[model samples]
Target: MISKWNYLPLSPEQDAIKKKLVRELSLSPVLCELLVQRGVTSITEAKKFFHPQLSDLHDPFIMNDMDKAVERLDRAMGGKEKILIYGDYDVDGTTAVALVYKFLRNFYSNIDYYIPDRYDEGYGISKKSIDFASENDFKLIIALDCGIKAIEKVAYAKSKGIDFIICDHHMPDEDLPDAVAVLDPKRTDSAYPYSHLSGCGVGFKFMQGFAINNDIEIKKYLYPLLDLMAVSIASDIVPITGENRILAYHGLKQLNTCPSLGLQSIIHLCGLKNRELTISDIVFKIGPRINASGRMQSGKEAVDLLISKDMEGAKAKSENINQYNEDRKKLDSQITNQANEIILKNCKDLDKRKSIVIYNADWHKGIIGIVASRLTELYYKPAVVLTYSNGLVTGSARSVQGFDIYKAIEYCRDLLENFGGHTYAAGLSLKEENIPHFINRFESYVSENILPTQMSPQLDIDINIEFNEITPSFFRTLKMFNPFGPGNTNPIFCTKNVYDYGTSRLVGRELEHLKLEMVDSRSENIMNGIAFGMHEYNDHIKSHKPFDICYTLEENTHNGASNMQLMIKEIRPSE
Candidate 1:
């Protein structure tokens, strides 16, 4: 599919800010422009952005109910109460559970962790888990990455003499749970300065507050667990800015230098043990392996691997999780292909449809989110992929850029038994018979709310620059913008008048990728680039034709030699 290129040139005000920043920092105008775009108009702000310090994170107690949460935690440990660490089934949930459990285990002995089975318990705080806690004499439950909306369940736990301390980042409903403490950054009355924390980030803050309250040193106790925080932040797709940046910046350091045994084992299994890691490595490689355990089997297995103490045992567990990842990939591919076929055959006037709601009872429930994502990528529309699970139609929904799938799902809440998620993604369940009504309502809502630009795939080019502008020093500065994700994305540069040198060729197994040695009109330097799935443009590129390309710069290592390589996003023949 051809993509629309969206480039916004700097306005006068932005240009003024960029020039002022350039003057103050003595940096390239382009670099200044990027900084200014990120709302860093001053030199101090730039320094903080590039050099995130752990000390700069907001005071954890500033969040609403944090003091109460910490107090309850202190009381639980003081009384030697059997504390249960509860979390969701995904990467964020598992990581949060692991982080909290690891920290508390250092001081407290009467503690255990629990991860609800995805199929058996569904999402969030499950009644079964509450009952299990009650039966196990778990008097206090510290719920991580979830439980902001467990009103009835928390009440039930309260009746059973179990108190709840919720550390969650998801948007909370108006009526908060009657837990001992509800710690969510998104709480309407929250005083927390930064609100975009991942579920695991909230858990980290809770731990931070707990340590501060009890006079525990943060550097020795808390900093070491940032590896888990980094994985959670990246895998959960949270904005990497403010406190998150500090957490991920240090978390990555912990991950690279001294990862826990389980993470190290998984890193070695991923073949990423020797190299420096990035957010992409976590998102694509480590996170999936961790998530696969939950997707294919039990999430508790993931927490077990995360908190493993033995090296050999962690390796064995990593191997098991890797197999689950492999299984998940196969299932994901099959389901995505099947979903595509269903969409193409049943949906007439596909372009006219504002959203997609496809149902297949035979589809695996665990992999529908991936299928929904695939549908959004292929069709460029909000998509819901549903399957029959225990007499209800349950599934995941993925939205295109700028569209809020969660809101769209919530708009049809009367038809849904339960639903919750962020703007771009969500999960929902309803009566099997409500599928048709859901499709219509979801589509109508999207049609009314979604902008036309959202229905088309667009690549937002950061800036235009010639190949000569990319110097070693420039690339080094760019590398300082590490740990990029939703908020702080890696820059995308567009270079025009690019010609493929004679050495360019098709490199992939099916000859479906362009491995290009490119040079532009302004530069004599030959640039190596890869354009994936763009084989149709290979001949056009190789026939001495000049084309404009937009790409993000990445380092490619081949046989122990590293060089700058452009991961090209789009290629358009010069008009």
Candidate 2:
């Protein structure tokens, strides 16, 4: 699909700051320009960005109700009261449960964990879990990744003599639950310095608070839990800035150097043991395998795998989870194809429709979210994929970059039985009969609210650079921007007036990848560029036409030698 190229413009003052940074850091002007674009105007900011330290993490007590949560946990542990760690069934939730449960088990053995069944209880705090805790005589429950919206559930648990300490990162509603302590940085009243923490990050802060209050060194727990935090942050797609960046940076170090037995087993299983793993590896390889367990059968199995102590046990669990991942992939592909066919058949003019909402009663509920996300890639608009579950129409919603899908769904609240989510994604449910009305209402809401520019995909170019600027040292400096994600994204540089140097070819199994050697128009300098899944552009390169390209620089190693190459993002005919 063609995307609009958005070249970011910098002010004269910003240009001066970039020049100063180039001189002070002894870096290329392009690297300095990217740093400036990321808001690193000074040497100190650049240093902090390049070298993220765990000491830079904010005090956990800064979060509202953190102290209370820690104290409650301490009191429960001291009295030998049965405590339960309750979490959702996704990567963030399961990882949060594993992190806290593993850490607490080192000192307290009375604590247990519970992951609600996705099909039986759906997301968040479930009455079934509260009933289990009550039957098991648990006095305290720590809800991870979810519970901010569990007002009625918390009240029910409270009525059953169970206290709740919620560690959620999702935006909370105006009326907070009556839990013993609600630890959410997104709370309007929270004083936490960083609010973009993942659900596992919030749970880690609770552990930090507990350590601080107990006078135990926080590093003892913090260091060991970093891998889990890193995985959670990467999988949950939280903004990798501030404390999240520090956590991911150090966590990745730990993950690469001394991962948990479970992580090591999975890495070995995926044939990624000897190589340095990136955030992409974690997101695509590790995250999916872990999520597959919950998506297929039970998330508790994933939590068990993560917290496994022995290599043998971890490997055994990893093998089983791998099968689930295989099954998940098949279902995902099949459902996505079916959903695409539905969209194609139902909507004759996709551009005219502001939204895409399709329902298949036979669709697997677990794969609908993935299907919805895949649909957005094809249509470049807000998409909702629904399936029948428990006699109700439930589904997931995914939005494009500039749209607030949650608000759009909220606007059709009358048609929905219930719904909740943030700006970009959400979940909703309604009667099967309401599907038509809901789809029409949702489309109308989006058409009225969404800007025309938001309909198409966009590629944001950080700066324009010459082929000569793509040096080995420049690529090395770019590598310092580790653990890239939402906030700190890999910089995309555009080079204009370039043509293929007689080495363009379509590679990959289906010839879906474009590989070419590009030559600059002015200086005739050359660089290799690869555009994955852009085989459609082979003809233009074959014609030897000048084109502008946006891409990111990466170091490619072959035969023990390394050099920089451009990972192309977009290509456009030169004006």
Candidate 3:
């Protein structure tokens, strides 16, 4: 599919800032302009952006109910009452549970953790889990990644003499839960500086508040769990800026050097041992394996693997999780194909539709979210993929770049049994009979709100440069923009009027990829690049014609030699 290239040149004000930054930082003008685009105007902000410190993290107690959360947890631990750490069944939730459970288990006994069964119990603060907690004589339930909107479930737990302290980051409703403390940065009344923390991040802040309240040393107990924090932030697709950046930066350092036994085992399984890990590594390789456990089996298995102390046990569990990931991939591919066939055959007016709402009663409930995301990417529309489960139709929603899928889901709340999520993604359940009404309402909401340009893919090019501008030193300086994600993305550079260097060829299986060696008029450098699924352009690329290409620089190693390669995004033949 072709994509529009959207390049926004620096404004005059930004040009002045870029010039100043280039002079002060002694960096290239293009690099300075990129920093200016990221709102780094001065030396101090640039320093902080490049070198994040743990001390730069916000005060945990600044959150509204953080004091109550810490005090309640302290009282629970002080009295030796049974404490249950409960969380949702995803990467963010499981990591939050593992981080909290691992931290508290060091000083407190009579503590346990619970993960809601994705099939049997469904998502978030299930009464079944509450009953399990009560049956085991638990007194306090610290809910992570969920329970901010569990008004009735918290009331039910309260009736069972179980107090709840919710640590969540999803957007909240007008009425808060009756829990002892609600720690969510998205809360309207929240004063916390950063609102984009992952669910595990909120749990980390709760632990931070607890440590500060009790005067426990942070270096030994708290900082060690940053590996889990990094996983959650990267996997959950949270904005990697401010406090999240600081945590992800250090968390990646920990992962590369001395990760937990569980992560280390999985890293070995991924064949990534002895290599530096980045946010992309977590998103593409590590996070999926962790999520596969929750998607295929119980999420408690993921937490077990994450907090495992024994290397052998963790290695075995990592193998199990890897199998689950393999199974998940098969299911995801099959279901996505089926969904595509359904849309093509049934929905004849596809172009007129602004959103996608597809249902397959036989679809696996755990794999629908991935399918929804795939549908959004394939059709460039907000999508909802639903499957039959426990006599109800449960579904996952994924949105386009600028659309808010959760609000669209909430607009159909009266028809839904339950729904909660963030701007770009969400989940919901409804009676099977209400499926038609829900689809119509959801489509109507999306059609009314989605912008015209949002329905198409656009590649935001950071700057246009010549091949001569890409030096070894320049690439080394670019490496400092580590741990890239939603807010701070890897820069995409475009170069025009470039022709293949006569060594380009098709390489991948079935010859569906382009392995290119190219040069431009400005330089004799024959840069190497690989463009996947662009075999259609192979002849044109070799026709001695120039084309404009936008790509991100990546380090490729072969036979112990490392050099820069362009991970090409889009190619436009010169007109």
Q: Which candidate gets the maximum lDDT versus the true structure?
A: 3
Question: What lDDT tens digits, residue by residue, belong to model 3 across residues 529-572?
Answer: 99988999987998989999999999998777888999999888
Q: Candidates sorted by lDDT, descending order?
A: 3, 1, 2
Model 2 lDDT on a 0 to 1 scale: 0.89
Please identify which of the two predictions, 2 or 3, would achieve the higher lDDT against the true structure.
3
Off by over 4 Å in 1: none
Which pairs clash (backbone N, Cα, C closer than 3 Å) in model 1? Answer: none
Ranking by TM-score: 3, 1, 2
lDDT of 2 by residue, 1-575 (tens): 66888886789999999999989999888888888888899999999999998888888888899878988888898899999999989999999999999889988999899999988888788899999999999999999999998899999999999999999988787899999999999999988888899999998988888888888877776687899999999998888988999999988998999999988999998888777888988999999999998999999999999999999999999999999999999999999988878878878978688889999999988888899999888778899999888778898999998788988988888888767767888888899999889988998999899988787788888888888777667777789998798888988888998989998899999999998898988777778888999888889888998889998877776767877788998888898
Clashes of 2: 0
lDDT of 1 by residue, 440-485 (tens): 9998999899999988889998999998889888888888888899
- Shift of residue 251 alpha carbon in model 1, Å: 0.9
lDDT score, residue 460, model 3?
Answer: 91
Worst 10 residues of 2 by lDDT: 468-477
What clash count goes with each model?
Answer: 0, 0, 0
Give the lDDT of residue 232 in candidate 3: 97
Candidate 2, residue 540: CA error in Å?
A: 3.9
